[model samples]
Target chain A: MTASSASPYQRLHVELDARRYPIHVGPGLLDTPDMLVPYLAGRQVMIVTNETVAPLYLERLKRTLSGDDRDVREVILPDGEHTKTLASVERIWDALLAAGFNRRCTLVALGGGVIGDMAGYAAACYQRGVAFVQVPTTLLSQVDSSVGGKTGVNHPRGKNMIGAFWQPRAVLIDTDTLATLPGRELAAGLAEVIKYGLIQDAGFLAWLEARMSSLRGLDVEALTDAILRSCAIKAEIVARDETEQGQRALLNLGHTFGHAIEAHQGYGNWLHGEAVGAGMLMAATLSQRLGWLSSEDMARVETLVASAGLPVTVPAAMSADDFLAAMRLDKKNIDGRLRLVLLSGLGEACVYDDTPPDMLKALLDEFPRA
Target chain B: MTASSASPYQRLHVELDARRYPIHVGPGLLDTPDMLVPYLAGRQVMIVTNETVAPLYLERLKRTLSGDDRDVREVILPDGEHTKTLASVERIWDALLAAGFNRRCTLVALGGGVIGDMAGYAAACYQRGVAFVQVPTTLLSQVDSSVGGKTGVNHPRGKNMIGAFWQPRAVLIDTDTLATLPGRELAAGLAEVIKYGLIQDAGFLAWLEARMSSLRGLDVEALTDAILRSCAIKAEIVARDETEQGQRALLNLGHTFGHAIEAHQGYGNWLHGEAVGAGMLMAATLSQRLGWLSSEDMARVETLVASAGLPVTVPAAMSADDFLAAMRLDKKNIDGRLRLVLLSGLGEACVYDDTPPDMLKALLDEFPRA
Candidate 1:
């Protein structure tokens, strides 16, 4: 099915001047072939996908852009979050060079957030920043990674430790792509969806709660509208503070805690969306303890996450101390101080530098029981 | 021993608006402490040097940058052309991130072309590109690598195969930086210097012939003026076309042949400068064979390189076929066709795509037996 232009998909643009991009979200945006051709610049196109999603929707997307001047190539990487490693990145770069790709080539990332991040980074490093298009195939990616130009492979020591802020030429999010997604993956995506509400748009959070059941059941209109709104909000925030300085740090409400869980559990054990879901709840739990959040607000976050079928608590295996230790090494950490993005309330967060030890201890203590 | 502001040196400006950089070259330029301040930005500067050059001048440069807010951190990598791999890049990135570097940080690359290339790539990759200053401590880096913003790490499959087109904030040359350089390195640097003459400045080539003995002895004025003029020429070419779309290819006159040699011989065995030196001779020889260059013009290139203590002929161990095979895999090669930068005359080069194989073969057969 082609994307319906009638869907509430607004184009959120990245302000990179001549190298700028647009994020298009709606039901059939993927079928809009003409929108992407301008940036291709008569260059060869490489669509990088993965196995799991390829069997589902890669063909229709490929058929959309089969034009006379555009010569398209495909390289499918192994599927999953764990594949975002240096080995994979090297493979992407090598494959592109071998294919006679030059400065005039465009890389299309066609899976989920993993493909988008790795492919975007590969484009950035390939001949030093080529144009990339994000055909984000997952909800987490459509709402998050696809919009921001943060691309990289994971280091053994840390996540996205080696990366670049490479912006993509355009982000095409087909809501139809979501129809083939597994229920668990779809729910995992809601974690990020809910995250937007808690961090930047509390009103979106309430809308999510009211329409939670319909979204969980995959209502096409609601899903596309939700994805576009999330993209627009994220685009505005990124435009203002492209780098995670002041306002952008708010976007990481659940990420500091989320990174610890992902790194501690080892990548791929829990989906990144799952880890962020738990981390978002932890942030809410800590906020309640700090008296910045009421017990009702914390419960509201937990109830919303639970309704979306996301895990709402930390895993029993990892000690809060280990989580703290892992978080201290986060690239976000300033000097020796552990900087965490704490919520002032729902729909707001600020970078909290040098949090008192007692507050950290109290927060960790709350992670186990509350 | 400070650089004389009055009559001795020429200042060439690289104007990219806010990213503008000044190329300061003259005798004793290293001792001019104030010249270092403009590129430093804030206070902290990290000096990335290599084992070969560190023992000689790292302390002097560090002392020059020392004051109240400006503290210098030094990282020394192993010496050799082969050390420009991604591993070295990781070490540099790890060092910078571990040191709590923010976006405002500046890096000073203080060695030869290898050190300059590696450090500049690191600065470009770290935190998604930072301001890096090139304090080229070798002749090759001072005159050539310092002026160009091409920064990258070498991949095993290809040299500079994975990189970005990042420009340095400024390039500072202390003719004194060349004093500690060994004979082989000094000769390697002149290969690139000779390129400027063969490609754009025939007068400069003739001047080199007349003062061959004085230049070999490292006469301060002659050396410094040559470096400044070479940079001025490169700065002009680069300002017009930073990316090698058109005239920029002219800069690769000897590099195509030299890269093939370096690839076939393995990178470290032939220094990059050494490879280029041999490559230039072959380029001139091809021009003469093509009947586009006079015999005298070809002889001038060979004699000047030989006088500078650089190798002016290909190694007999590698056949012409081996060199051709190596050149075909160069990043510049597209669709298995070899593109060469050939001299139109003494002072200009034009890129010729897919030169007749017989022409390349005949030049190979004539490889300097006498």
Candidate 2:
């Protein structure tokens, strides 16, 4: 870990051997050309963002990347999770082809997780893989999506049904960009921030519990510290299991249940982090039922999630069968068995495949609905 | 290298460290479950073939994979190079998801280069990649496409413009399948075989020159030898440069010109190997012009290609500009420079980014057209 003295930004490397890359977290990092330029494959750069983010940081990024010898272009797609699809990615490939971009060109994902994922996937397949950089603007993206190279689009059947683990050349997280984020989006990001603490770091969890109000209040120092810790934990895990064969699956502490909510509700209905927030609560409750976590532990999990401004209940219209139907299709399952990441205790997670069907059904049936 | 004494099949391994897998080449290997069963990730199996091959080999493959414990499903896509698009791959994903295939499932690609590429890509992105096996039925695929892990779909703008380097768990080449192949398709496959000789093996070139008639006549021994040699060369190249960072580009001996011919003619109009046949001749001609190959060497190249039943002339409708336009989009090029693989000698190839535009144009304009 290294923080530049001139700027307040801290840097962490995701050590993937030959493909190792750095994640820089700080205020106004996007405007720093020195942060992004070294990672670009060549002079041809394509900036992929959404309509919402285009008006926010697009020009500033362009100025930072612009030079006499470099050719930089931008493709602004419609915003929202609904827009994250192969067709939209095709548009990015089309723009690259139309511009006659070569194999050395770099794709800079300049928005939230949706943009980062689609753009990273586009880079993954363009000319059978090219270089890409992640400039995640949303708090959720800065803390999670941008660090690991899990890039893909959602299929109608599941979330991220199609994707590849193509690591980016660098991740630029500008805490300053969070200033323009909606309060709900900010809250959704805190869900993932809280996730890091619950899964691996009890001390970080206590720290976040203490500073949750300050983070929501947009205190720069508080936000930067939270982002750095989140990225560090994620980067370390990714370095150990770049392909998610074993220990890395623990990071999906809330995703299996969360994907069910996102899919049943239709993509983009509930923001990814928001669904994950509720899903974490459901997992904790289930853990308590399984005798893994006590009721008090479950309460602490719920209070922290709720205090972060996330929902703590399932959608009213969803049935236990709906959750079962969707969870069965999760990517984590193996050989028709539902494999889930569950909490063994605070700051510790384990994958369980033996959760009794009746127990799960009872929990789903009895859990409060929003 | 290991040859099973019970059957006449010879098995060679592609040494990719942890991802290393075996390539079994010989007749009737497809009927042996021992070849494929060990490589499958789990009990869920999806066989992806095309309409043309499904009728011929799908049932036989299913029978080979069938067991009371295994769940087998098949998706038969329409045949042809033009059908190789993101849409076709989407259909494969839809089938897997509809079948409730999970991360532990395996995809078996059972067709020509088009089917293999599409299926491999589908597996590459389906749940961010699962296990896959290559059961290539075409002569072109048996010795070339199946051995290297280059999987992708063609974008309208370019060939294999979207894809990933997802290796298969195994590559099973059933020589018996070629008994039903069209003569022209067989000739196309021969083009790639001849390419192996031209690019990396002088001894193999001499062997091919002597055995050209035997190979064309479908002498099982000659065909098997050729396939083994080609795969051996390809597997070695892929292992050294899995992602085409350097030495691997030499394998694209005639691909730059071949791709231009294919793209201008519209993908399926000219078979990939057929275009490559003509492209190889064009490369040799250019090499001769650059004083890299003597006139005698060029004549040997032309004689070998002509004897293989492949077209050595450019397409009649394509002009210099047409070739240049498509070649400009070749994936091997970097930073707007046109990179081409040219012969340093009869059996050795080199990548040259400094090919003078006028010399290339002159060759394109003067090359004989069919």
Candidate 3:
């Protein structure tokens, strides 16, 4: 169906010159051929999805891009964050080779964050990069990962450690796909949605505070608004610093700590967003201790995250030392100094490298594991 | 020793705007701390080399970048084209993670083409790219591979099937390193040098025709002059098409067929330049068949390649079918049709997608494989 005839969709653009693309959010976007047709560089299409997503949306997406001129193939990988590795990306490479796919072929990532990261990375390296489109099926990816051009697999020692900043030709976000999303996974995605508010938009945070219940209910209007706003904030930051040379690093407000939480919990255990939820709390507390975030603001931020059904505390087993060691491995560290994204105040985040180790340790010790 | 006190080095610049870097070609470059120290972004330096090169130049390179504040480490892999794989790159990742090397760390590739390719790729992906310098020790790498930003590993299916176009911060070509290079490997590198002549500068080809003896003898002046000219031609093409979307494909004149030969023979058996030497012969013959090259010119090309002590014949085992299958996997292929870099006439090359398959098959049939 043409976009004109379809239900109104919220469109956000990632304004990277020459490499820019639009993110379309609405129900049944998977079936909108017009949204996908213009971005396809050639006739060949390879939809890379996970086993979990394949059964539910693979055939549906295939039908959307289906045409006699299009030769579409699908590669279904096993699900989970652990699968986000070079080995998994190699599988995608092998599949493309086996199929004799050329540089003209465009890979469509049709799952959540893991598939998007792995598939996009595969596209980036395959023949030194081929065109790819992101069809993010989960809220986490649709709102956060898919919009910005961050794509890569994970190293065993770190999260999202091995990757490329490969932008997709387009991002198609079908909110209807969230019906299949498990409750915990849904809550996990909300963590990133809340992140936008804590990092840059105080107004958005207040709106999220009042509309948290509607979002949890999967209210289409509220969900679309949050995803659109979140993507816009990310897209603006990404446009300004596509390579994370400076301001782009601000988007990782909770990610440095969040990545540590996921790594400590063995990747797939805590869920990325859940860890980010708890990690953001730690960042807020740390920011407060550093005289950046006020105590009342930190309480409000923690309450909003807690009310979203996300974790507000660290896992019981990880110690302050463990947190320090894990955070040191983050991509933001420079010459052994840990650069962190901390709030100067609620709804205002900035990257800082001056967080004293003693204050960082004190904040970490206060969090009861688990 | 400092660069000022040593014999003046021949310097050439690759004009890529913000990514522009200089190529320093001379003896004793490894010991010239002045050339390397300025490019280093941080104190942490990871020297990536091969087992063969480690004992020879590793310590010399370490001293060049060494300072009390600098933390230096080394990662050595088995030396061979076959070792250029995703798995090999992972080992680099593991070492960086183990050492807690952050994004601030810079990787120095301290070997030939294989080392440069794998190490450059590792740097490209290590935390979504960090600073990397190329200290290419082989003739081929200094003249071609290292000068351009084309870095990647080989797949069993195709040479450089998985990689990136990650440009280096600088390329330090210590021609003195050639003293330790094997004879056949040296000849293999010369093939690429001859390629610059055939594809772009007829004058270079004629110059190489006369100086074949001096180059083969590893005369410093002749080698330095050749490397400078070859790098100038490549940097021009690369600046125009950093990502082989256009003019850069011309540099692959023999590489399309050359890669197939390497893939078929099992990479590392035939040195890259040796394969390209034969492949260029095949490409010249085919170009003649297509009426783009004169029969007399083809013979001159073959004679020049043979005088350089490189192969002019394909392996005795590969059939036309094998060539077709291998060439199909090349990155230049589009929509399953082979796009080859063929000569329009001597000293002039262009990317062509319309090569008649029957003529290609006939030409491949003429070459007896290994």
Kindly state the fnat score of candidate 1.
0.30
Candidate order, lDDT descending: 2, 3, 1
All models, DockQ values? 0.36, 0.91, 0.82
- Per-residue lDDT for B307-326 in model 3, tens only? 99998778778888888888
Q: Between 1 and 2, whose TM-score is larger?
A: 2
TM-score between candidate 3 and the true structure: 0.97
State residue B342's C-alpha deviation in candidate 3, in Å: 1.8
Q: Second chain of candidate 3: TM-score?
A: 0.96
TM-score of candidate 2 versus the correct structure, residues matched by position: 0.98
TM-score of chain B of each: 0.94, 0.98, 0.96
lDDT of 1 by residue, A259-323 (tens): 88898888888888888888888777777767888888888888999999988777778776978
Which of the two, 1 or 3, has more lDDT?
Answer: 3
DockQ of 3: 0.82
Scored against the native two-chain complex, candidate 2 gets a DockQ of 0.91
Question: What tens digits encode model 2's per-residue C-alpha lDDT throughout B211-296?
Answer: 99998888888998899889999989988989898999998988899999988889899999999999999999999999999999
Off by over 4 Å in 1: A1-12, A26-44, A58-73, A243-246, A282-299, A317-320, A333-338, B1-12, B26-46, B59-74, B94-107, B285-296, B317-320, B333-338, B354-361, B364-370
Lowest lDDT block of 10, candidate 3 chain A: A1-10
lDDT of 1: 0.79
